[model samples]
Target: MGRLNTLDDWLNYQENLHFQDINLGLERVKKVYQRLFPKGVSFKVISVAGTNGKGSTVAFIGSIYQQSNFKVAQFSSPHILKYNERFVINSVQATDEQICHAFEKIESFRGETSLTYFEFSTLAALIIFELEKVDIAVLEVGLGGRLDSVNMVDNDVSVITNIDIDHVDYLGNTRELIGLEKAGIMRKNTPCICADTNPPASISQYAHQIKAQLEFVREKYASDIGLIGKHQQQNAATAMLAVQKLNKILPVNTIQIKAGIKYAQLDARFQIKTINNKTVILDVAHNAAAVKVLSAELAKQQCSTIAIFSALKDKNISLMINEISMIINQWLLVPLDVNRAINMKALSNEFNLNHNIHVCNDMQNAINRALNDKQYQRVVIFGSFHVVADALKILIPFMKNNEEEIL
Candidate 1:
């Protein structure tokens, strides 16, 4: 409306323009892509798809490429703080003016077609990457890879970080079914790296059928990473494998790879901070698999910890809670400010039998409750990105020291 000027205005317009929030088909986006760039992107493409570690892998790759003196552009999803976080160029986020300009261009290109919110963002990021003439572009799939908007751009190297039972409604219920959906990103004769220790047979089967060069992380990278948890080594190794596949063209040395993994930083991935004299760990572990990883890391803390948790309506809240029930001494549940967030009543029902549960008024109240309790040595904020974002808005202002997350 009225030539939307602000980034917020364009975001609002995109949200209402589409009938469904997640329209997972590439045709609509591909049409718009053709109109925007008929010749296609010139930069090398690395598309990463999976349930959990897609963002981390993208970060590691971008960091490694950046360390090698190559101009890198990374496109990711579901920004924690702002929409600009979705489009990053050379470690810097796209500005509001740039985003507004990209949206206006998209609005002009799509004459009669409809694009979903995520599709619009994907096109915008690609347009920016092309305009800036980035050397390489790393894209994280927003959902299932087969029909996801990001798949419109053919990747030079495709990566499936790890597959698990996630997005069951859209992808499928079983890992085999889900694996096929993610395998859609792999192209014939192209290098495809799957970082899952034990991947589904469907993944290798699909690769065999398509003749995609499928490689698994049989050996983990024996190096220390800046991020905490042993699982990060797998993600870093996956990124390394992708980098090695493109070594002839990209040419990143061992020193650069090690430096990149050690310097890479992504927020809300078992991120540690000291706020108001209390230790808080923020993780976006919405699914059961990710929650299991978080639980393992929490176990190593070996201190009394309480969790402030809430998840989306579609998530298996019971399984996620069970993963860390033994590690977390108390639970502070809070509702998120999103349409998909589970309500207080339903969330309370998940922890009904637990004796130490606190249904806080909001995220801030939950943090306060956890900090005031002297019994807990640590406060963990986990569930969805929405929950962690809400905590950051309140906790960032009071953060006194940023703790190094080392295992």
Candidate 2:
């Protein structure tokens, strides 16, 4: 085990540390974490879990608390552009040196024990957050909450944003089963908020069984959050309500709440832009449920949409297509560069000539096809995070950096 001085070196080393891609248990990671950090620091921990809105809920919580003069450490997954984006402190992404130092420390402690990619990265985030002594840490669950590496931390406040059918192989196919998995984050007597109106019975049942104080986000805010769509309103209300419940731990005011709502925004979740004199909406909506939200959002604009889409094979593509079919005038589908990339022939067979769908081998060619024969006012790039991420390669280079909008 040689020294991993650079961030890239550490990343590459961790990528192959485990034989498999996803090792869904926490026993090995927990042993290594305990060995590394024997004495956990004092900081309020907020853990959020759900199928679709986990990231937004996390962004909302981080934004609101930071506005109230608290230094926040937020750990999220699946970095769109860079690995550094996964761990953020005080809204500033971790520098390569800082991440490398954390990774090196973890590696030193985890000599014999092998950790998965997500588990290693999560430990690094925890180490950096504790080393930096942030006031609060918000953790977004990487997968099923129970065995997910992040469940090792006892959350002061547990948030279950919404339960949907996702990760069926790992978390079960039914919503009730998935809800039980998400409810694993709840702690005894801790405040647990379920922002979903029709939450699964397993969530409430498990909360009751554990004697955790559970509450639905009863208050809905009518005011606009800096982001788009009505779905954001629910997430904002959940964040504000959660903060209010945490007054005993970290008190906040209405002024801070308003300011937080004014500034809270996350990239690739309904992010809109103008590229080549055309309105381009970039969304990481791979699931059918999220596609429904994307469709409803598209309804806000009367103009037809030309979409550049690609998704993993496991997703319910037929349902997703049906959900967004009304808004999309044409579909420019491309193959993703992932191990689980869907077979092109199987995907193409889902639609016929009347669907106005065109196939491309890669993202660049798909973009060229979309631009050459522009049939609509708006171009939507959705279906998966890979779609938006690949599109960013073309967008960020040619288009003037819109830090204010994109960031």
Give TM-scores for every candidate, taking all chains together and pairing residue i with residue i. Answer: 0.97, 0.96
Tell me the lDDT of model 1 at 143: 94
Cα lDDT tens digits, model 1, 209-325, are 999999998887778787777898999999999999999988999999999999898999988877555678999998999999999988876888888989999998899988889
| Candidate 2 error regions (>4 Å) | 401-407
Name the regions of candidate 1 deviating beyond 4 angstroms: 400-407
The digit string of per-residue lDDT tens for model 2 on 313-358 reads 8888888898989888899889988887787888887776779888
Cα lDDT for residue 160, candidate 1: 97
Query: Cα lDDT of all candidates, in order?
Result: 0.90, 0.86
Question: For residue 274, what is the lDDT in candidate 2?
Answer: 71
